[model samples]
Target chain A: MVTSAAPRHAAPPVHAGPARMTATPPPIPTLLDSDVVRPAPPASRAIKAQVENFSFFYSTVQALADVSLPFRERAITALIGPSGCGKTTLLRCFNRMHDLYPGNRYVGRILLHPDNLNIVAREVDPISLRMRISMVFQKPNPFPKSIFENVAYGLRLRGIRSRSELEGRIQVALEDAALWGEVKDRLRKPAYDLSGGQQQRLCIARALANEPEVLLLDEPTSALDPIATSRIEDLIVELKERVTIAIVTHNMQQAARISDYTAFMYLGKLIEYGATAEVFQNPKCKETEDYVTGRFG
Target chain B: MSTILSDNPVSGGIAGSRNGGLLPPLRSRSLLGRLAERFIESGLLLAAAFSVLITGGIVFVLVSESLPFFRHVSAREFLTDRLWTPMFADPHHGIMPLVAGTLTTTAVALLVAMPVGTLIAVWLSEFAPSRLREVLKPALELLAAVPTVVYGYFAVDFVTPALQAFIPDLPTFNMLGPGIVMGVMIIPYVSSLSEDAIRAVPMLLREGSYALGAGKFTTAMRVVYPAAFSGIASAYVLAISRAVGETMIVAIAAGQQPNLSFNPLDPAATITAFIVQVSLGDLPHGSIGYQSIFAAGVTLFVMTLGFNIIGAVMRRRYRQAY
Candidate 1:
């Protein structure tokens, strides 16, 4: 069976026929200029989280350092970094959960709608901004509620009062999260009764109920076992067709496995941003190369 | 975060190494330590037992006092009878009027509390930011801890007059004044309990609602409220119990007369208030007068206990299973 080779940013082989062994290559630059691969740029600004000069600070501590990048619309963009490198912090900024904690400060523009550029101002209404960008945390956090109610939660908030309408929506959202078949018969059952994986899926279903335009996943599969992680990975693909996604993953394999684009950050700075294969194989920046190649955290 | 590795000579390390190897090893039991530990454990056990025992004793006493009334007067007549003339020589001590009065006050209090308390909870939990929420939560709960007598005093001195200005013929001791005051007293019970429940809802749920383009108020009212309903329902029950069992406020603000009227503007009496009226200062024990107070006490106890049971069961059935 022919499979599409791993998407761009994969390092092309450096062979001996090119005299690469004899001629010690200079410390190679990482970034592959866009012009090298495709001649002309696309017409539309097609991306979900367009961060322009985005810098975030928690009180006096700087978290994200002037990170400028765009997450392709409906295409998964993985922010890969080690612990405390600000991937989660950056992800939280999209949905504004950081706003809940005091002393969270930021200076930048994060654009959800590339078409209209609605969030150019730093003082955008976070509630409305957050509504367009749904988030799933690292741990599965289904409310202490029934499975049906968990999925129905966001839909109900939208004033979908009719039981039939709610049920229909709950079914669709659960199905979208790939959790319906297992929980379909037990909608009234408590959410905690489900397996860890199922609970994560139910949380995902709850998020989906609101029909968000962008989904932010902060190490969503970190706590799940491999099988559940695989299921979530598959669901991410299925979800992408409808809404944009920004995923923060520490696992390099996860980034390689699922994302269309990958951004590598180190010490709270976006070191490299490009197609996943290009970023992984031929990181233009020494920092990105060192980080991605396992030479440095 | 860390332990120090000191080069102490004998006593500090292994009880002697840091202190020139002078002291003998101490066993796990020292006379003082053993005694203190035992005392502490027993104290905790006794404290916990007393907590349970106190609750049990109250239930036992209420039932013991109520049993004779139930035996002398059939449960059906006590529950269904229309008149409440406990002091009357002919003995027309029907409890229907008292129950009706209790229900009227409870319903009106609920009507007042559910909306205002829920709104305050929503505002405190969802709308208000950290600085304001910290300031407001305690201030709101302070409403609950205010002495009941003080609330009663206000009901008579402040609320009754204010109410009369609107309703010209309002009675000085009317259910409306007490019911409204009771609602105010119980607001903290509803607001704080509900605010906690709403706040407990995972941030993810709120985020999902927000992402759907629904407003904050919409998300809180629709999403968080229903998710926290079981807890909120429990809170409501708690508030109702508080309203129904309140004695001083209703006794002073609402009239002592048990004239079976459902109208809020008219004077009516609740079971607890009637107990206060009957049990005031000099009521001879073993007499029916004394027994009537016990009977009223039993009724109040039963109603409050029922609310607690319902609240607990509802919470258990509809808990945050996940």
Candidate 2:
């Protein structure tokens, strides 16, 4: 299942030209300087999930306000903004993670495609919905279990009792995560015995074990060193070919380098949504331009 | 100072100070401050060392006193022969009966405490709402605050009578009543410590489980329990130690006859109860009968020490697993 290794620090191939020069020093782009309109994702790709006028409240405080966005099929959508800009909040709403806490309310629907199920509906079970939508958290959080068992956890949850089937699926998931080679000899070792980067990959392998249709990543490398972060970035890029991916990241260059689409949120509002190249190089929204150009965040 | 500043890039900027000294030469501590610091350090050290000294002294006393008793009774008889009638005209000093009694009562207490305490901990840590947990924890701890003497009476006066209704053959001073009461008394120690351990597990782990679609029960059993295993193991050990060394409940409720029987329905005397029974009477200070209590004390000490070693090893193993 291995593909040719992408170059380290590779920018999205579609947008790898002069347009991507905004990352380096240039005359600081002012809010009024750019007039380029937001370029939408091409109509050829199908929408995998859509957030329709979604708003969220933690008791009385609204963390997300009337946010609407689309996750394109088998594509990486990056959510970027300042801290508490509701990027993570928006990503969590996809799998009904807020349901874990009381007094957290969702006012609009997150419609999953194919089945078109309203994931946030009260009648819908968050546990069952989470089966099809898995998540990798900000910190690497492999269970206090053997590496093999960590990968097999979600499979066992789905009642995969056959030992051979579990081993096969776990192998594929670990291979897909690029971790099987490093950990193959000692699958019975504890997950924490691995380094931080490997632990995060084990988490990804754990999420992948479910073969979920959608995968949510919340700052999956914020805790790692640059080298480990780059490895996870490479893995995320490869993962988008199989599962619809949405990521929340503070690293703007990272968002630019990996994401197919970019959504900029500010103060619980979606400031802009478009192709990653347009968002970084030529944002339609002034806040998006100011934030993306490192003028302010 | 100039040499130091020239060698360090960060400190070079401060080299132009009027005095050649770097940062005012860090004001020397006053004599009074130095004295107070020394006093506090030694005072804290003494406080810590005080407990260790007391424990060492107790072990010395138990060993010295028990040496006389072993000279009077052969070690093989003390270990093997079941009869333990030290005050009889023809006394039999076999310690087997007391050891058997202690083990039986402790086993019964653990049978009741381990499972019940663990379930209570899981409920408090994973299932209970925060407000409920806040109110419930301190209230549950009140179980431990109730004096052991009260638990002893409750075992004899209330529990034994209640059990008698169903099992008419159970004697009034049967070990079963006191064992269950001791377990109830120890519930707080186990549940409270286990709850703290389970609660201390980082939220990230639970989120990982939930993201995998595991329900609250599954998350608690599969993820939280194993993650908190070391802490829970220590809690269990503490409960075992508490039950083994427990004095009042068994002394009052379980009959003080050193009967070598494992049956819970039979009256028995644990090591603690035997000690209490002997210490109450006036035997010559250095006599074998009086010295037997020290021998019993040593056995109890050994049992608790073994348990603590097992707990420490378990805690290290699970901590390393993570």
Candidate 3:
């Protein structure tokens, strides 16, 4: 699956022989190399959104500095980085989540394709932009409402008032989030009654109810147990057939397992971007290689 | 263990050596320290018990004083009788008129308080800038600090005349004036408490709504409001109790006559107002008029208690709901 997703490039050599027999190890990559070589995505895939030289600030402190990356249509793009490396900051910028606070500013353009709307433009309404690009938070944040109402919330925001319409859409969203089978009989129960994993799926169902074009997940399974995390991973992999996905995760194995493409960020900059297999096995930049190999964060 | 011995030389040398190099006992060694701890615990327990004792004392007095009044007037007449003319030459002992007056004023006050207070709370919690919130919160609390007597006069002298300009038949002494003024007085309580509740709701929930394309008003109404419903409900109950027990405002503005009418424009005396009137008059100690106030007092206590019980049940239900 990994090799199939990689774009055409000079494949890195694999060490088939035992490393101990060589009596010496390969040279470790150093951070002095400045150039970042981002292997292009396969030609068959189209770009869903392009973030161009985007910089973000929380008051006077810059969180993301002149970072550019692309999310391919109907594909999973995972962002992996250490804490405070601006991966989550860049993910939040896709839906303009920063607009909720005061003294936060966006510089440069994040252009949504097809119609080519710049999401970060001051004149663009965050509400409308958010409607097109939905987000699942780092922690599950289901509203203090019923299981049914939790999924129905976003649908209701779009002015879908008919009972039948709401029910049908909510069922579809819940099913898509892989939670309908467990919760079908208890639609009226409070959302808080659900276990942690189920509640996280309910949040995903809530986001999916809007039928957003792009879905952003910010460590959506970090708070879940292993079984729940695996279930969510399977659901995310399944979901990419319909919606474009951008995820931020600290887990390197998770990025390799689930993502079609991966972007490694460090110190508020994009260190490397390529197909998941290429980035993991053949990182183009020293920092990216160091981060991917767990040499240093 | 060695680090601990090094850190504390006295305990390592004396206490440890006394225990044959074992760590010293976890319990305090000083008798004075143990005694001081016991003293503090007893002092705290006594402080807690004192409030409970006072409540028991008040209940005992109300029941005891009410027994004498109930002896003179049958329970049936005291409850069903419409006239409460205790001071009349041929006095009637019915409590219905006073109950009606209390209910009418309370309903009017709640009508003015609940929605207005909730709106103010939502604005402060969700939309107000930090500087404006800091300034407005203290100013709103200042309204609560104003003397009830001053509000009473304000209701009678300012509010009544201003209301009369619109409705010419409105009486100078009517429940409407005091009811509105009392609602204004209780606004600070409701808004402050409700704002605290709304603000206490986790920001994560609000972000969930906003992430789904919800505007500020939508998120405030659907998400923040329901999340804070229990706290807001408690604020409503407190405002209801305050309006029910308010004495000066109703006594000064609403006339002292007992009229069994629910109309806010009607001149009537609430239970609290009647209690104040009877307390001021030179009625004999054991006279029926003097005993009548106890009956009114007990009735007020039961009504407020019912509201509080209902508020508690609702709070529990909502606290679990989320």
Candidate 4:
């Protein structure tokens, strides 16, 4: 029997091992080729976050259902679909932003395997989880502060108070985000002085300052112009070498251009996932092909 | 007014409303509109000019009345001396006592108002749910609508009794009771202003802070709070000025005894309370006794105006929101 697993609170293991996955595709059209020749990358062998029968609920309504997939370690993974396809919700689940809202929850098995453990345990400290998986938002959301303080905000949270230490971390993080040269001299200036694209890069730098192992971007360049978008795309390419990256983007071309691995999600289901090139060029699932080729969401 | 009179494109410019780094010559329209426009525009301008006229009249009245007091008591002595006793046969009054008392009460009141009001504002804006937040915000603002005299009554009866229990030797009428109650009255003003400011912080900033592993408290303080500080501070300064000028609470609850003392447990009078004490019943108009009240009013006006101006400057210096 095919396993119908789910993502939820409580240790997902101990009750199971070597689980089966679901076959439901998302709101996006699955490509015909994704069914036949999904090019699973060698890096997927080192899966970091594994979901089995992963289902989500906003109070009572289930947003996602029976999603079984492994997020590959140390690669840029893209979650692509039309709006309300549960991509952003799925991303939020990885760090539990839903905890702030009342009665909202996730059910089933989501496993983060550094210690090879399940992540959905009731005892999981969400703060630490968030520290490991830092997120940059769709809009450039800098604090009302100097550029230096904006980047130092995360480090200050972990109790690094020394100015010199904060400065060095700020420099390294900005360099990591590919924003050092543009903003290095104007560290004392207010963050609002920067252009829309620069502010987004500054946010990326801010997230990296905490030395997070994974970076999650939810449409990080959606508010930016074309020039800023390209700058961020370049930054994302450099960043993949240092830390794992996951992005949820509406722009499929952007997903195709920058991602190492791509998951096509439509109607709250992950329809097809494989190599970025494969998912775009020759998707096995017919729905993915239609969505990719601009037939329909 | 100029808008109706001037069909000239120069209306959009102090210099010129240049776009894309290129200057265009002023565009004009309808010569007929320009002809009758001056008379109509002048009438509107004159209407607008009345506000300035009213302000100038008040200032002229104040200066004319105050000129005699300055000849008898230099501005230096009136400002620096702490004791005020113009009612005494010898008449050795000083404005310092009133000024000091006003500052002390206002400062202490701010200590109370700023924290309580800011916390309530934060709760109203960021933490509370939509339905509850909607209900709570207006309810908090209703605190401001209550008559100051009612606050004075509450302070006299409820607040003074409570204080007497703690201090054992508390006065029946003291600045402490009135100042605290006055702080409570100003809470809505602070909260309303701060709530608007905090709500103005974009949702993205809060979401970004949350994503960085910061708790709600951390996000509110480090991110949201600082972003809204300019507006919140203006609210606080306004509250201070209100506290200094507040008459009913202090006049009825805090005994009108002008002295250079800050011990809130002891009876003391602010400028407003002193003015109220003097103004009660006719005290021979044009006498030094009656004129003293105007002197206090002028000082009160100047103090409040200074606070307003300084608050404005600081707000402009740090203009930022995100």
Candidate 1 lDDT by residue in tens digits, A1-297? 001222233322221123122233324542322212211123333766689899998999999999998987858889987778899888888777776667888788777665555453556777666556778888887665678877776666567899899988888898999988898899998787999999989888888887888898988987887777878877887788899888998767667667778888888998888877567656688787777666666
**lDDT of model 3, residue B45:** 100
Q: Which candidate comes out best when scored by DockQ? A: 2
TM-score, every prediction: 0.79, 0.91, 0.90, 0.82
Task: Return the candidate ranking by DockQ, descending.
Answer: 2, 3, 4, 1
In the range B70-181, model 4's lDDT, one tens digit per residue, is 7788787787776798888878668887877787777767888989999999988888898998888889888888998899999999999998999889989887888899
Better of 1 and 2 by DockQ: 2
lDDT of 3 by residue, A1-297 (tens): 222222212211121123111333235442212112223346558999999999999999999999988889978999988889999999988888888899999999999998899999999999989999999998888888999999999888888999999999999999999999999999999999999999999999999999999999999888887678778887898899899999998766567667789999998999898887568766788888878777777
Instruction: Give a tens-digit lDDT track for model 2, residues A138-173.
Output: 989989999999999999999999999999999999
B26-143 per-residue lDDT for model 2 (tens digits):
3345789989999999999999999999999999998988999898888898888879988778888888888888888888899998999999999998999999999999998999
Docking class of 2: medium
Backbone clashes in model 3, listed as residue pairs: none
**Candidate 3 docking: what grade?**
medium
First chain TM-score, candidate 3: 0.86
What does candidate 1's lDDT look like per residue over B229-260, in tens digits?
88899889989888888789888888888867
TM-score (C-alpha) between model 1 and the true structure: 0.79
